[model samples]
Target: MADLNTQHMIDEIRDNIQTGDTLKTKLVLAHLPDVDMKTQNRLIYELSRGDVRFTVPILLYLMTEHVSIVDELPVIKETLLSNLLAYPELLIEFLSDTSIKDKTHLINVAGELRFEEAVPALLYLVANSQDEPEIKLIIETLGLIGDPQAINTLTDYLYAANRDLIITAIQALGQVGTQSAMHRLAERMGTDNEMDYMILSIFADVQDPVSLEKLNDTLASHYAHMRIYAKQELVRIGAKAVPALIDNLLQDDPDFVIHTLNVLGDIGDESAIMPIRKLLGKDPKSANVRFAAYEALALLPLRKGAYTLTAGLTDPEDHVCVAAAKAIDQNYSEILTAGIKNLLRPKGDEARHIAKIIVSAQVDKIFLSLAAEDFFQELSLVYLPHAHKDTKEHYTRLLVKHGFDEFANKIQGGEDVKNLVKVVAVDDSRMILNIYKATLHELGFEPVLFEFPASAIEWLQNEKPAMVLTDLNMPEITGVMMAAEIRKKYSPKELPIIMVTTQNETNDNEAAYAAGVNKVIQKPFNAKSLKAAMDEFM
Candidate 1:
């Protein structure tokens, strides 16, 4: 029986059915090897057949590691679904763990179990933090759960105080794609300002007559973005949008005329040819208007206006010349080759750069590929190290794709300082606290954890860490106070102190500096910035 307590409590729970000692059950479970595969499988069966209070820790461990419990599907449906209906605290704990990666699986489970009770927590997740990406997918799952109660919460966020969140909510609503969602989006199209692009995108999927009229009217709006959005949407709608675009082309509004012409080209409707042909003579001076007309003429399948495009190559306006060049490049490849050859021949340094841009914009597929490589190489040189870590991957990929394979190799090998660096994050949020732990694991650091100032002081007395990365608003004692204590305890020449916090607590920064913290990294930290901050300490 000694092995009973030594074995994981999940195992003990399965074994100790006779004793019924619940505290021993929990205490034993918390210490057990959290990820033991056989123990986990047996625990799933136990949870399915009977109620257990220790389900939170099991769910958390599985969620953090992204473990898919496909074998435990029946148990998940039985226990988690029942608990979710009876006790929302379990759902709250599960949803709040940001490290969870079986988000899609959990979402599917939520729907299958019909956990309508989780709607409030799901909405809270969507409305609250910027940390989780699963919220968007979860919102769609909530709708799939088919709980009508989530409608009001989703609608409220769709018209949020935060514009970015409003966009996210709108996108989620589109995924939900209910009749009420369409109606709400259609109303938003008529009333929302500077959202013409979003509205038109939603309208293409929606078959609302009112939304169509609002989009058509927006073509004549003063905003150029609106005109562009309307044209794109009309083109996406194709034949249904032809009459409205044709009607707008007849109007005298310059934005209306220009956008209508662009839509006709994108739609490639042969019916637009006669109206487009007539527009060329009306405004020969306005190059924007003329370019739009020429672009549409070139889109015609019959290619009747080939001479008009060719004749415009001699126009004095550079933009008109470029437009004509682009139009001709569509039908005739030799013209593009000859045009590029002429531009590059004996051109000065200024001409070479312009030729680079022009060639990048060319219709020849091979030269376009070369131009893209050059453009991205130039961009990498410009934004290297300054861009976010997410962008650095693309910038490095571009370098690798080009002939700069050695340069890409150097970049990949350059960030090896992570082994020499260390990070110490102190936060009350268990998820963020765990994130700090996992980041250290990934970066190959020996991390130390402390929930209170006493624990931090105890660690400082014994060990000499490379650097300290602490959160500001910790309980019992603030991180700044801990920094002062560290400064008092440690030598001035020892490791640097770097404070991390979500709250600006302006006074905290000023005070932390006063207490001799070497640096401070704010929350919502990108991995690159965090790495660079640690590199300084190293």
Candidate 2:
């Protein structure tokens, strides 16, 4: 038997359900905990009769909080499903409601049901609505529906002025994941716009053959940014893109072929080996294509490719030779040892060139061998101090061990040269300082390295070095300010200052010169440039 209070609560809920007021329905729901199970069952049976007004809240409560009610009153489950399916207008009407909360709840219901019948109404709302939250949810619901009819509607919003809506539309199209949808996304990549990266990411996710072909076409795009975006997407697509990438390599376009080679290398798939080798055998005249093929072959790591890489060692282009040698160094170090032994024999220039390639790459490692005496003599013809200090020391030690005492002494004895120039060098990057250290020592100057410009400036007050090398960009004090402070005590002739910077700031360069800097060298400089700048003053 139900208690009188429970009976009264049931009567009040029934009246509220009849009134069809959301607030009254909520008030009835507030008293549900105090009601008996019989009263709860009575309330569910009364409300389960196709009442669209209580449909969302009841379903939300049943789905979230009162899930066990489905087991107790199994008819309620069937009723909720049947009512939602029978009356799609209820959800459609909720979509136009002013409350975002109510609209969001109905959108979730539409997605949960995956009701294709609701797609037309959802599309209508998305087309007519300018509210971001409503449009976002509506577009999201269409993605969950994944009906073909929604594709054009979603694609139209891809170029919306609101970036959030555009991104949401892109994601929705990715969820659609149809070939037509993918082609639509790929069509936007022709322009070098801000959306290229986002489009590339979508392509990477799609990974369909159509998307692969489109991305390959982008590799030949005149815009470098578009080509880069395509290349990165191809690499990200990885082995899935291998077949299409190989097909593109066969095209007559040299630029496309070269970019395909690089992408194939980055993918590092062995399947590209034979095709790349065929290209190398044909001996394409373009050094770019040849170098790209060499790099791709190196990454593939096939034993037969060693001959081609070795042939590249004698190529006229220094970059090609270095690329081939680095490939051998990373993948085939033992080949270098064999090449060194071949140098000992009375081989032709090919053998000597191969030996030089091996020595340039593995100079620190191979110089330790007894056969390195001839190689060391060959290396001595050029100053190879671009390596770090520890590597330079190792190479110097190897030269001394192999009986090139005079050559080794000349390199290691650079400090004893007449009036050994004391150069103060400051940079925040330890890597750059190490490069400077090796370059300065090679140029026969003692470099005083400081990671901080302030400390370098303080040291400059007392000691007068032959020159000061400082980075234009520093944390504590910029190179220009430090040079200005140094100019107060000494003239540019007395203390020549060289400023190295990575940024191409012509105005800053002018300012630095005005602040007493003798010369400014841009970053990515080599030993020759550093030596040239030092020779200008020191």
Candidate 3:
């Protein structure tokens, strides 16, 4: 078959493609010897701005060849990238090939594409090379890639003897460094050397446990510079470090308790659930703790633990009761509805009122995780409110004991919608979709809504949402195929697409990624996890 390609086939394919004959053109492409570089480049250029048919054979050919199409890369850069973002793997092939004449050109292309996978090869080049102009290009490219993998390598090179190299790596780290990378940079705070300015620059961004621990241990140091850096790192960690930051809620410092409660609420850890609930009940008047508890519940995944907060739907604190009402709506609206028939002749007006408020607010729709589905199933089964206050307390304590506090807190707070920072949710499940929609609205985002790929694409062209959230199984277009269509027709650099589903098989993930889904978030996602995935863009 390799030798069977008639020159007539190539000619006919080109002619058919020029005239918009999709079927005949694809047939011709299937028969062509894609390894012939000159012929391949000619075919690619002619159809570079055309549909995505040319992509498959070209990418396949590049993968198998393991060498860069040096002469054609410029044409690709000038023509293809301006119109369509090429596949990262194809760009990686170009960047990694030592024979490519314009290494800088490859780096530039990678930066424009935000090709995270190319970071390893680019870092290797930067670490091993002595070329100043090329090293600068490599550093800039690494910054653009922004993969966590590049952070460690770039940080190590920050101490290199070459001043320019040190500066480049430091700048690159600043651009892409995570909590851990910042911690490393902060560790070298006051060494007072040529690299001190770079380290000081990095200190402004570093915030994590390791850095905090380092700062705490060195608080007694006489240097005013060290003290300033320590105080800044503490603030940067923010209200999310409460439980870890405070020794104990009951006997902790007032400022510590205040900050810790705020942090627990901000961080949305389930481990803080019982403690927060205890505070809510004891000092039911403490706005700081009650608000923190409510936030904690709202941030958590709705589950059995949320029953405590749901019982508190009549809590004196307005926000606490409000949060409980929302949780009832977000987590148990269906169950609460089903349970009404089984309840004694008189249904409680408070529960009814809270449920009404929840139903009124829009719900978010998204794929659910296995654990989250189980939580909903349980809620569906036995949703009756126990008569005893101790019963609620006991269940809340048990929930905390069983590691269900996170879900409990989330159910209490209502469905969280923090991923609204940069996302558009799409799915077929009425309930899941409602939950996601509600969460996004709660997070203060006006996400573009779509029930299918056809609708999604229409919205995408007009709105250009920063990221797309989609489910795998659907009636119209499957998530994978939709992803391929989006990548094929729209510019990936303009909008990153994330696919969500219940499937966890490695092959499924690989296929989704190959189809051009930038990130895969499995179903039953908590708001915190979803928010973390969204935060990658920042």
* True-vs-predicted CA distance for residue 381, candidate 1, Å: 51
lDDT of 2 by residue, 236-355 (tens): 778988998888867888768877987998899888888887887887777657767776776786755464455667776544555566565545656665664554455466655554
For each candidate in turn, give its C-alpha RMSD to the true structure in angstroms: 21.8, 9.4, 22.5
Greater-lDDT candidate between 2 and 3: 2
Off by over 4 Å in 1: 1-24, 34-37, 51-108, 111-152, 162-164, 178-200, 204-217, 250-254, 273-298, 301-538
Off by over 4 Å in 3: 1-84, 174-180, 193-206, 214-218, 232-538
Task: Please rank every candidate by TM-score, starting with the best.
Answer: 2, 1, 3
Weakest lDDT window of 10 consecutive positions for candidate 3:
362-371
Residue-level lDDT of model 3, residues 1-538, one tens digit each, is 5665556665676677667776566555554344465665665566564544444333333323423553444554455454335455766666666655456656777788887778877887877777878888887788777787887777776676777877777677767757766665665455554455455535444544554455443333334234334344444555544444444467433323443444454455566666766765675445434544554556556556554554545554433444454444455544444343233113355444333323322212111211244434234213213112222344345456656666444333223333445467887544455546544554455556677778877766666666788876554466777888788666566677777765454655786888888888765554566677766753
Which window of ten consecutive residues has the lowest lDDT sum in model 2?
380-389
Index of the highest-lDDT prediction: 2
- Among residues 3 or more apart in sequence or in different chains, the pairs in candidate 1 whose N, CA or C atoms overlap within 3 Å are 424-469
Clash pairs (backbone) in predicted model 2: none
User: What is the TM-score of each predicted model, taking all chains together?
Assistant: 0.39, 0.62, 0.31
Q: What is the lDDT of candidate 1?
A: 0.57
